[model samples]
Target: MSNSVNLDDIIISKRALHLSENSSLDEMADALQVQQRGVWPLYDDNAKGLEQVQVKTFHYAQCNVKVQFNPARIKSSAAKVDNKSIKERKCFLCTDALPPKQKGIPFNDEYLVLVNPYPIFPRHLTIPRLEHAPQFIEPYFRDMLELSRALKSYTVFYNGPKCGASAPDHMHFQAGNKGFLPVETEYSKLKATTDRKLFSNEHLEIFAVSNYLRKFIAIESDEMTLLQTAFEWLYELLEQRGQEPEPMLNILSGYENGKWRVLVFPRDKHRPDQYFAEGDENILLSPASVDFGGVCITPQEKDFKMIKAADLIDIFAQVSVTDSYFDELCAAYAKRVVE
Candidate 1:
């Protein structure tokens, strides 16, 4: 850590340095891959995870949902995040516990941008807080947006502690190389087809996309202050509705052409019944931000091979906010906008 370093300074200097050195995300990704290959056997083993993964796509309700059989993710997909379990394990995101060779770029002088050993995208990064902090988002979402802007070629996402964060004990966000998720391509169509605009001003545009299989609210703005204010308003509303600590949600953010697009999925359930189901009915599918964004991860081959369009629709219905609830939230938001 340097005394002269600040968020703006880090953003400007790091991107300038990296752009001069690597020129593009692909080159930087290759550098990370090379580094991981040299020191991280786990990463090398899981980089091979893509090879063993079998992918199947299904068109459900006009949305293309892809299921991937990723056995290497079983440990994460089935982690017991109960208090007892979390307390027993060493916090892997902690700097001291990190592998010696795992290097990272400084972020805001309070976080580190490191390559994710287990990746869902070809180039995935885990940005964890320098201090061991409980997984929380509202306080650091502005930072997430800044990271997205700095990365430019990647989409940043956050999984709530209970919703999908494997390291629930630590505050972190992940970035994946753009163009990986179906949601990125389908979003434009979704806005036109299913999303209902809830708020629009010079500074921001907010839309609720409930009919898009998974219900979520999308906010876009070029100004961080406006976006942050809107998010806080939504947070307060959800909290008043009794979502403790914070609303159970997952977020996906992307920055391009001077606009930051953020999608927030409000959740009522953690894992669906199929996760706890017996024998043949069991599917280890966990609905994370990426899952809500259209790519579902199935850690078991059988589940991946067997999950159908109807099953996906059902899983989404079970995990996402109910249609009625989403409708109510949208209505409330619309009314607030009008008032």
Candidate 2:
């Protein structure tokens, strides 16, 4: 299917711009929020859901995980992303398929940043490519870096096709207000004390954070090219070990203090067995970058209230790569960097 909608057709031109030619993406996004709330009733209602959302925190030795009871996220948490189901449904991320009232800010004539109607953060933005494409990160990882820098106040994240993307066939990245996730605050502490250093130099540093409930690789650098090169190497390493078309992983990135910090959450499965379990056993929780970052989303209130620390441990264990595999991958990457 073709994304036939023109850039001019969906760009929030009038009020969002304030007649300014140099409005930053962050400013434009704020403007889009105001315009969307007034013009889009569905978004307005869901945006209000953020207020009623309940949260409970579970503390671990090294970090804490927050479970958000967000009823508005049922559409995404329970999204049917199977190949057959995906083929039958229209692509919602496509510009032509968006609601009439929905509008966005065009980025470098490549992506359209639109307000997410079903939000998990106080301010949520969904940035989708202009063309219809599969959800893959390698080719667009640099774009993510650029977006994070451009929207400095937001954390840009990617949910792999099988990792957490509801629309697995579409290419998109999501941005939420910074500090919404626990990792944004906890990562520095982990890095200083417990995280295992894989590689480091003047331009780039990579560390493996295995103590966190979910295992992830952290890449940090002040230079964009160096960061991108390190990520590409890591991507190749992941591809060599995985059977999937693309290595199963979710990425969370942010730009602050003239540097980019990227976290890669490698996955072994999309959802835990609890997701498919019968009635009382079923916990409708589908983890994405936010979840890995420590704010686990539970669409159903029952799951929210009943989910315990042990259950989260079990879920993370089931979805994340095994400890042995993770260690081996880290070792291999560390060795490769030196050679």
Candidate 3:
């Protein structure tokens, strides 16, 4: 992948919005509307796909999860992320490879924000780096925070290369409308009820949440530096557990009222055994940040209709770290932060 592609070749002048440190939510909302209207035919078709989408909510003891039967997401759900497959295919996220009808808003001179055609949210944006790079969060976690703040109407999220990312060869972050995910609305109550405080300071507070089907660490802060430091620390700790290239994780970040809330879901595997199972036992689910956040996407209508709450519990358990490991991680994190 070459970084020599000119920005003008990809950006539609009329649709492009200037994003900066002081960009406002209203400005982004307007830009998104303009872009959608500018690419009317494509978005209009995607709107029809959205209309076909169906949802079913399963109630759990501590929380509820919505399973969406979105047939348009089959490409992403069944993506071949293996090295050979990735090498043979073109990176769809690259500037030159983008669809002819697609237009983007230039952000911070480094990223381009484009509307997602196969969307789970009513308003979804995929932000990819202008330069082609591998998916890795260590170097760009700060960028995620800034994007969440600038795109205040959206929640910014990352899916690890080996986990949920379809274009693992390209570096990207996705943003969807705020309050769209169940976890966003449930976080405050979960924090007060089930989350165990791991660390706290004047600028940052960290908590480990285990009751949410999947185990995860949550960091809340009004300061970017503190948030970055805490995230990097957690990344290092997870890395020490021996995953190659990078640790397996998915993240969801949101900014509101001058504060940033980041949820990190560490994974032990990409997909559960059910994904590879044959015949009637098979499921096509590939869990990602959104899935961990409370809405799981099922590309096959049969899988969606047949999946039960017990299946969800088993799937989450198979992909997430064990309860004992989570306990140890919490203890270690608490001790390390105080030191």
Candidate 4:
């Protein structure tokens, strides 16, 4: 739309920039020449479809997170997996969150607080289901216990799978460092939601508008039971809502001051790294929220300059529950349909 874009438009916009994996700020400055796009986009050819980033800082950006695949690759990966292991397999999480210490008091009909084994952040924990089922806003209980700590002053986080998860399986949630993304942005914005009467959890926030493009944030509760019950209804609805589910989902939660926040992202975005996939010449397609927002920091300049911002967006958005991934996901559900 704006001429602010360059000839390569997708790959390298006029403001386009790249930061190789594990790179420092100085290294980034040396490569950009102008030394600062302030906020630039990111991508991975290793990725299969539309996915890019928009970030405010480069020097401090970890750059450790990189996509390893796109939907095509995801489909391929899913296809290659041995489905024969279907029935006898145990949920990895149930196995790992083992030797259960004292379980916290159950919060709602479907939700409960439990310890997370492979934590992404400190006190990494989960607000999962008591029945062990899958749901999209899963791992996310509208706003569960892992809240108070994900605030900017506390920690940062990255959700995967359903909302950006590497482990699309296992019913759980995670909270981590404030380095990349603080957990409070969603919390402070809760009061701004449209239906103020909806939440009773007292901690859930609600947005008056869809805050981020394709992204909506809110926390609501009419009462603890209302919050819990509404979610129970949501759980029943999710059987038809969150595709096949891989039979599970995870949420990246954050917050502070008694309130909780969450980002219900989709995971199918992670692709294996090129080195991890095939050879040194291979590329990885790891897409993050920053990339979809417009600025992505890739380890290679080519990824930043190769795909168009719009192109990446189109692909990433498809993973939304309302999109085609639903068709593929639902088909999987149909197969597992219980008689």
Candidate 5:
């Protein structure tokens, strides 16, 4: 799945080149509003949802989880993920198929960063590879870290092919305004309460977040090489447990103060059973990278109205890896890496 287009041939605007890295991305988002008619209409949809959106905030000792009813996300929430169904549709991410008004900034000669029409955050973006490819993180984890650094006001995230990615056939990442997800603000507090240190070295430290209700691993480092190595090791450990092309996981990364902080959510399932339940029990909730980051989106009003804190707890527990497996994996991680 490769496209023949050469990234260098793509012309980026002179204004895009003159602005600072972070400012350039901000301007691109702003330009999308005036350049693309679809942007604000969708934003208006978000505003409408916010007004009518039912929300339930679960109180936990570690952090609070916010669930929002956003009907605009139904397409993504209940996307047809089967290979046949995927093949039947046009690849929307492809440049030739993109909306005429949509424009993007060339990123590192391999990706195009564009504003996302259906936004989960106040400001959201989707960055896709020039060539079509499967969604995998190992090859691009370092790039995610770099993007996080370049867009200092945003957090970069990845959704695995079997995770929440709607365009599983295209290698891509997403960026959202910082502080939108509770995880960004609650990480340090959660770390203090839940950190299970696996390995520590001069520049890199790895910890498994044990008490955050969902299973996740955190990697922090000032050195990209060291962080990449540790991340690969973690990937391998998770990969060995399953036979998939890559492990089922989602990633969130942020960089500040000369260091990168990455959180990995290991998943055992995509949609929870409630999504498939009979009439009265069915919920249109699908967990994604943002969900793991503490904001769950439900595209149906009924689902949002009926869902409770306990239901959310159950959904997370069912999708995330079991506690015992996480503990064993952490112990193995400690032994696999030498400080």
Candidate 6:
């Protein structure tokens, strides 16, 4: 059986790029500056059967084989911005004072699912916080515990307010279905490499996958102390690294192989939404779900846009451009502290 086999017994693989040999990446990115709307279905000609793919900015949907673009669906993620839009940056994630909102899954005290009108995905969801506080995943630790416990089947992730959050005001989280990621499986099967430091005992269990680009973790165990200890080790490392110096960070976490996994994304500077290349006022262009998932989408239909998925993978591996600003800080601190 071919690896491309799906439920329908169709085997598919990488087909081809959307642009021609003459098309340059700069041209594609320049085109995105003017307009941001583009997507193309992919097919594997050598597959056993015909498998058509529905490519989104963040994901590829196919019955037979999964597919994604190399760079990005669009050239630039910059978006138009205005004070009016900025002023409206209320932390809607934890707006319990509001009413119960629903997108796909039902709402609970811990977390609620709401449709993000200005979404990268066609039906993107915003997991809001009930406390209505500044955006931070640790504050609502129980929420993550409950949300993950309830939505055991889903993939939950947290992008630190200063890292990749579009709204850094209110604290909230995100959850989506499984199988949307490429490395989710590969990460699961990954054995411990020499770079990792395992922390496990009767009470505390923590394992950190210390490679570049992707972060594999084993966060959950039968014991709660293990989780707490793991979190502490992670936080201590964060403290040593001085990640607090940064304004934000991007993070991706999910469950597979019967354990939890986490990847710490980084950033270089605190840039506003304009960095994304949105005409008016929107700053984006870094590691994100669509980018990591090898798919991406743009809601705006002003011009033809296309996402390069392979670009995302490579970009993520460049932690300084993506991972939280902890590695350099911590590594330096360790050197200073020891020296």
TM-score of each: 0.90, 0.97, 0.94, 0.42, 0.90, 0.55
Error of 3 at 81 (Å): 0.3
CA displacement after TM-score superposition, residue 140 of candidate 2 (Å)? 0.7
Candidate 4, which segments miss by more than 4 Å at Cα? 1-164, 169-172, 182-205, 208-211, 220-230, 246-250, 265-301, 322-339
Candidate 6 all-Cα RMSD: 15.4
Residues 1-339 of candidate 1 have per-residue lDDT tens digits of 223334342222324334465355434544655666667788888877776667888986768888888887788799888889999998888776776556666666887777888788877888899877889898998998888887788889999988989988899999888888998999899888754889888778889887778888999999988888878877767666676556899999999999999999999888999999999999998889889888899988889878888888888888888888888888887776557
lDDT of 3: 0.87
> Which candidate model has the greater lDDT, 3 or 6?
3
Note each model's CA RMSD in angstroms.
Answer: 4.1, 1.3, 2.3, 17.4, 2.9, 15.4
For candidate 4, lDDT tens digit of each residue in 251-275? 3344444444433343333433331
Better of 1 and 6 by lDDT: 1
Query: What C-alpha lDDT does candidate 5 achieve relative to the native structure?
Result: 0.81
Question: Against the unseen true structure, what C-alpha lDDT does each candidate score?
Answer: 0.81, 0.90, 0.87, 0.35, 0.81, 0.41
lDDT (Cα, tens digit) per residue for candidate 3, span 218-307: 999999998898888888789988986699999999999999999999899999999999999999999999999999999999999899
Please, what are the lDDT tens digits per residue for candidate 5 over residues 220-255? 999988888889888889988874768989899988
- Which of the two candidates, 4 or 6, achieves a greater TM-score against the reference? 6
Top model number, TM-score: 2
**Pairwise TM-score winner, candidates 4 and 5:** 5
lDDT at 45, model 6: 19
Segments of candidate 5 deviating more than 4 angstroms: 1-54
Off by over 4 Å in 2: 1-4
* Candidates arranged by lDDT, highest first: 2, 3, 1, 5, 6, 4
Tens digits of per-residue lDDT, candidate 2, 105-222, equal: 8898889999999999989999999888999999999999999999999999999999999988989999999999999999889888755899888878899988888999999999
Which pairs clash inside model 1? none
